[model samples]
Target: MVSTSTLTYSPHHLNAIVRGSGFPILCLHGHPGHGASMSVFTDHLNPRFQTIAPDLRGYGSSRTRDRFQMTDHLRDIEALLDRLQVDRFLLLGWSLGGILAMELALRHPDRVTGLMLVASAARPRGSHPPISWQDLAFTGVSGIINRVVPSWQWNIETFGRRSLFRYLIQQHTPLAYQYLADSGMSAYLQTSGPARNALNAALTAGYNRLSSLEQITCPSLVMAGEADRHITADSSRETAHHLKNSQFICYPNTAHLFPWEIPAQVLGDIDHWIDRHPQVVASSEVSSQ
Candidate 1:
């Protein structure tokens, strides 16, 4: 029944997708990606649990001024949940969204019944690898060439457009490329340049949350791609270590886009974990703000 609008305005006026009817699963997309970008996971997870995927401010149709900070993003999530009347539920985050998930779990200790981090890290300042300058130069050159030349391709710009989304998927897999292109490219490219810049700055501002993870004593799940270049698997493994109650899984031959790369398996794992917790207070609680 994977039917979802994945668009339109929430009561709070944020752009989001709400689907299915069961225990809630609030999905937070990574940087440069919108609610639709999470369709791969939400579509699968929705069969059992309701999924709430929202386009964070400054991205997709939730356009706002270019300037926004971590606080603003957090407020957006809080307000959206408040409007939705979600009392407690599981939270899932991918990449940058995962970091926000950690912060939010800490903020709403009672609201987040469980936490799931996909290809994410708590201390992103040091955990996630920085994109090299060479990538930037190539994306710019490719964008120029795309204006004139044809077929020859390169990435690194705004990801999913004339950008580096290819690098996120498992390399050399044509189906992976086409899958992401068809399902997520449009939303990824909709990112405003200034908003993208703002997100970039926030990521590099030396933000770290490792020491504070102990406070989030919720049942947590950390899934990582063994081949992820953006965020190392070891870092993800360590993120699980910080949580007093957490499990870590690494998939071989998968990269940063494992949710899209291996949707079925990922969903199975997520389902199994959620079944064990069932939002019981004694089971644990934890996500993105």
Candidate 2:
């Protein structure tokens, strides 16, 4: 079962969802998403392994100010884990969350038993293709609108009271779309405009992990969707290549939203990776004594 609560950490208060028990796994969601966005994976893994998902500052139920930086996000995660009493465990990051996970692994490899990156790259927006004129125009307009209007009002005007199921699940097969709807992911798309803007700025700032990738010594898994437009499979391959110890997998016909599009497969792959690393470590520790 999933339980929800809030944790106050300094200037921010993060909303978190926790489920199951035993070995812990901290799940991080992507941009324009919150902690609940990992529900599909967490629901499947619960009871077998404890999963803690928190909405990053400036997103979801997390409280934030006008601006949010990458460093602040990293600090929030560290404080959250400390408060939760999680000394070390696997770290699973999807999309932007993956970058944060890599940052954590790089900064504190000893605290990360294993790492999983889904549809993510080493650099900010590294896998994304060149922006088209239409995309640029859309962005310009959105930025102006976001700056002018309040987040809740703008969200209501643009998406109305209905869910964002249709607007986000594009390019995927009909079956995938239906599956996402069935999974109750519409709510996951709800986020404040400031949060969205913060993420956009962070991406535009051109953060890269190319030089630091070699420093990550933890066992890592990188999964990419072959058809992902935002983060291409090549980026995932590149990231894995830089890692000293890592495994990479690319799923054909899968897009950026593979976690929701192909939940079972993604979950299984993650489970296998965790079993091979952290679980193996636990077994060896027992045997050694």
Candidate 3:
């Protein structure tokens, strides 16, 4: 729930929200999302875990002077971690942030105590896959609504950015999941269009780390929404298969923005997962949870 402090870090000025006082937990948001989106996850964790939610380089309030790569973001997080003197911590990421978390754990396995990936995957578009008839059924009426007279298209074109930002945060979630639409407006609006495009380009441009995921040996928790249009639950299952020590969970009747859909459950799951991994150990020595 913190995130007011904005500090200038290397590559770009990194604004972050550091709250609570316990084992550190660094949270990262998805593409076109800022650090604030992580508030849904970090808000309650403050009492049990120290949460560091930083706006990634070229994201949110961070300045996007030029096109940035995936590596640039990793460096920013590393620098911020170093600056804060956080030697080791748990990592939680959603969507694009999950990809980065995997990369970070691979690059520095010793530093990441554990990992929590929500509605995300190990690969790029492979995470989303192709929407099947079953998924279409899960989408139900919302799919028809969007296809016929999408709120996003209309808001962006006619209502201007103010309206567009609100819908974009919802990400076309069905009516049942649109209750928190207003809460996410600040996150989508702060991020620039170039930042979103760059992140998309980065994901689509040969961004596959499925093969390399086996190199990471940290305790990992992977969760996905059952009806997530952007990233499918099956893709998340595939990701868990590649990991040596990982647990996977798929929430029914949920979408890409599942955390917002059910905040209490998300927090409970995270707490239970973190409690299981008090000490980081290699997969060879312990069984996957």
Candidate 4:
């Protein structure tokens, strides 16, 4: 049965949800989303594999400062796992979460049995796509400003284009627009500086992180949306090419929000991949900044 609960890992209090029972699947959220975002996929997973989705530091019920960066967020995940007494588990990161998952697989390979990187790139350096002023304007400045002062009364209102905004709310009452509006403020304040920092870091780290990717020992799945406007489809292809043991998949007609747009398909691919890689080296090492 699917269940929702909260846990405190020392200094930080985290809001999380779990479902099914068996091998644990840790779902990490991307920008502007919290742990609750996993509800879409958790509902479709097989009953055998349990799922744990947590609100990253400073998002949702996870409390922290506004300048909290990805490294801090990763440490929060480690602490949460420690609190739960889970020594190891599969990691699934969507978008920004995907970047975190990649970091975990590289730095803490001992703890991560497998990895799923959805719609992420390697820091966007080197020969990576040139960042146009328009791209930066929308992603960096415009996005930050919009979060601080949203145009919509509700969060998912922008999805009105495909009627998905309404349908999702109808399906999952907890994901209503009001919940986003109510929960967004804390995340907005916490991620403001960190988000900018991450963007800057991405520009410098980009294609340069290929060496780190090559060192990944865990099996990985790199999934991208065919129609993603933010990260190009080639990003996933390049990520797979860099990793020692990795595969890639591109979902057609979907944008960056493939998790919400195609949960069943994504979950199916994940379940199958995990089953295929049942034996992984234990990971105890942590990422070195």
Candidate 5:
């Protein structure tokens, strides 16, 4: 069963969901989205690990908070851990969330047991903006579709694909097709809410803080899709280089959402790494028959 709770983070209440029971793992989402992005991992975790997926402050059920800097997000994660009374758990971040997880590991190493950065770039180089505003435009449209005609939310396919537009239309219900165009317009008119401004600030801060990647010291896994257009393979390689101990993996023919498309392979790699870690192995050996 899924357990949902409201967490009071000062000015606003953030919604958090936890399932399974054992070691805690915090999962983050990407730009223009929320913790639901971690839905791909819903069925792929080790039985010994409990999963904690939160709607980041500015998205989904979480109330938008002030101070959307990378540091701010890190603090939020820390507080969330404190609320849960958990210590030293693995951190997984996808896309924009990957950057956030990286920051969390760098800033609060004591709280992170390991790091997994999925389809994340070390630096947002080149003319393209660090976070795509265009993607947000489409995401906002999709959210409005959810609010008006909730049933349309059922067909949110192709989350781990580059061609969101094509998949969305094909899977959309009759009402969703209409709501995306209509309700999306209304939602756009009421834009610039706490979430938008907060995310924009976070994006700008992320671009500015790209150089701090070298400070990370953890067993890290850097993953990227072979066909990720936003952040190319070159940047992902650069990201891996910055970590003290890291492994880089590229999923062939995949886009930014690798875990969603191939959860088994992704989870298997993660399990292998965790099992091979010196501390984990040492502990297991002591308990073995």
Candidate 6:
């Protein structure tokens, strides 16, 4: 069973959900996604590992602020870990969350034992051409509109939300779309305009660690879908190339929503990877040693 709780971090609060037991793994969701986005991992990973998924500030149940900076987001993760007394553990990040995981590993290597980056890019936007036209429309046009529109005006119209959701669903495979729709993820994707703007700014501001990828020393597993329109497979390959010890895998006939489209395959791969890298352990063990 998954347990939900709120952790107060002075001025703001983070909603977190935890499940299973054993090695602790912090799961970070993508932009416009909350802790529940990673909840699927719990269903497949439980009994072997404890999954801790939290809503990032300004998203889901987490408190929102006027401004959402990368530094602030980083602090929130740290604060959540401190509150949970988790000194070290593996980190799994999907899409935007993958970038955050890389940042955390770069900034605090000791705190991260390993990294699992799923359908994420190391370079900032515009670093390379988008893989498809749908990618361009979604990131270039819709992204701008979301940033410019007022929060009150955004998602207020049923037609607008439905249209956007439809487009988003169209990007995924039929199986993936079905899973997302059944999980009520379509509603969750309707984020406030301000939050969307904040995320867009963070992503496009060009403050990235692509150049510093060689600095990451931890073992990493980079997975990407060959058909992912949002982030190209080349990005994942580049990321793996830079990491001292890393593996890259591309799912054939899969897209950005591979987590939902191919949950069993993804989970199995992750579990096998973890088994090969058995050094990843609980925080208490590291402290005891």
Alpha-carbon lDDT, every model: 0.73, 0.70, 0.70, 0.62, 0.61, 0.69
Q: Which candidate ranks first by TM-score, i.e. highest? A: 1
Selected candidate, larger TM-score, 1 vs 6 = 1
Cα deviation of 57 in candidate 2 (Å)? 1.0
lDDT of 4: 0.62
Point out the higher-scoring one by TM-score: 4 or 5. Answer: 5
Summarize candidate 3's per-residue lDDT along 6-42 as a digit string, tens digits: 2323455588989988778899988767787787778
- TM-score of predicted structure 1: 0.79
Q: Largest lDDT belongs to which candidate?
A: 1
Better of 1 and 4 by TM-score: 1
Candidate 2 lDDT: 0.70
**TM-score order of candidates, top first:** 1, 6, 2, 3, 5, 4
Per residue, candidate 4 scores C-alpha lDDT tens digits across 64-121 of 5455334566666777787777777888787777777787777677678888888777
Candidate 5 C-alpha lDDT tens digits along 1-289: 0012223334334466677776677887665555554656644663567888877666666655353433455556667778888766787887767877877776676557678888786574322334467566656655555456544534344221122433323224434344334433433343326657655654565463446766777688888777666566668878898778888998876555456556678888878887866342222234344
Residue pairs in candidate 5 whose N, alpha carbon or C atoms collide under 3 angstroms: none
Candidate number that wins on lDDT, 3 or 5: 3
In angstroms, the error of model 1 at 205 is: 2.0
Writing each residue's lDDT as its tens digit, candidate 1 over 51-156 gives 9999887778888754555556677788888888877778899987898789889888877777899999986522334566765665555444443433333332
Clashes of each: 6, 0, 1, 9, 0, 0
> Tell me, what's the RMSD of every candidate?
7.9, 8.4, 8.7, 9.5, 8.1, 8.5
Q: Which runs in model 1 stand beyond 4 Å of their true positions?
A: 1-12, 125-166, 280-289
Per-candidate TM vs. native? 0.79, 0.77, 0.76, 0.68, 0.69, 0.77
Which residue ranges in model 3 land beyond 4 Å of their true spot?
1-10, 126-182, 280-289
Per-residue error for 11 in candidate 6, Å, reads: 6.9
Residue 100 CA displacement from its true place in model 6, Å: 0.6
